[model samples]
Target: MSMHQAGIIEKKDFDVKPYYNQLSSRTTHLKDIFEIYYRYEISKEEKFVMTPGFLNFQDIKKGTVLANSNGADVVADHASRLFMPLYQNQGNDGFFAVRKIPKSFLLVSAFCRKHRIDKLLPLLPGISWKSKDKDVLRVNKRVARVFAKQLFHLMGYRSKTWNKEYLEVRNREAAARYNEYQNEAWFRAAFE
Candidate 1:
């Protein structure tokens, strides 16, 4: 069988045995050689660029191109999901339409609404909290599980919990673009 068909290199080459031997000798134990090949191939391509971390919505734009290597499993998993749709043979004939309202406006509106909801969550009935020794509020897990985490994700915020008690959230948008979105009517209505 030819080395290209055996999945050694992305493109067909005249000789694969030498390249395969070099790659195999570099690793002490058996591993996924295809991933090594992918990294090497991507490095040679001028248009492809791989980020050391996860790609957020802010990193994607109309002409933005992204590549991924096997450095981080989380990054690879996310990149696979992000690029999987491109490999599928699907048609969007009637599934989508041009939006009359700008997407940024819609996203900002959702962000404002989520922020308002978060502020009011601690005051809702069935919600109870206590201040920990370090002045951190330990919210009721029942309410947090039902609302906070999922809501934050939907509004483009990354959420994490400390000891299942304190939830921390960070916006996923680019910091440089914060001022641009903050001036929107929806952002002002909820925040200002």
Candidate 2:
């Protein structure tokens, strides 16, 4: 059954449980299932990961036109119309590809490759304090979810935005200031 698209989460929302549980029949279209699930309500167990960088990030050059004209609304409206409809529907079976990889995965992987860290990569523990009983898996899973959004932000691409060489150099300078902090967190997470 086709459900109204209004109720479902957009492409950025990472919710999986709602849509996964909403299937009435095996043959229901994926989009329909997603719409019904996202339209219903947010669930406690479902995770939402819209990182600030993805939402508020942009790269505009000097002298770029922020167009001030009667046609401003028309341009903005047209862009909105085109993008809104296809934000999550632009791929087959929920997979969008920019190159060989799915757009979602590629976007996230960009950040990971940039940072030299995989955001969605599951963090496997070095040793199990409690053996295979539970402790090791628990920490590994927890670390993965917590770092997933951060890693996704680093690897994922921000559409219509450009991070030029100048900005990359500037960010590198800033990241140096956080060298100790990164060493502590990521190093420990990786080695410990």
What are the TM-scores, per candidate, against the unseen true structure?
Answer: 0.29, 0.17
lDDT by residue (1-192, candidate 1, tens digit) is 243643544454466678668866864353421111012223222232344343211223333334433442113322221221122223321111111334555576576655644445447754433433212234455656667564554444453545554455544442226576566554566554
Predicted model with the maximum lDDT: 1
- The clash count of every prediction, one per candidate, is 0, 9
Model 2, 91: alpha-carbon shift in Å? Answer: 12
Best prediction by TM-score: 1
Candidate 1 Cα misplacement greater than 4 A, ranges: 1-111, 125-138, 170-192
> Where is model 2 more than 4 Å wrong at Cα?
1-116, 119-140, 156-192
Q: Local error of candidate 2 at 106, Å?
A: 13
lDDT over C-alpha atoms for residue 105 of model 2: 58
The global Cα lDDT (0 to 1) of model 2 is 0.29
lDDT of 2 by residue, 1-192 (tens): 122233234435555556656653443432211111111122344332221221111222334332222323111211110111112312222111111234565555444555655322324442122233221111233343354433433442121111221111012322344455455544445333
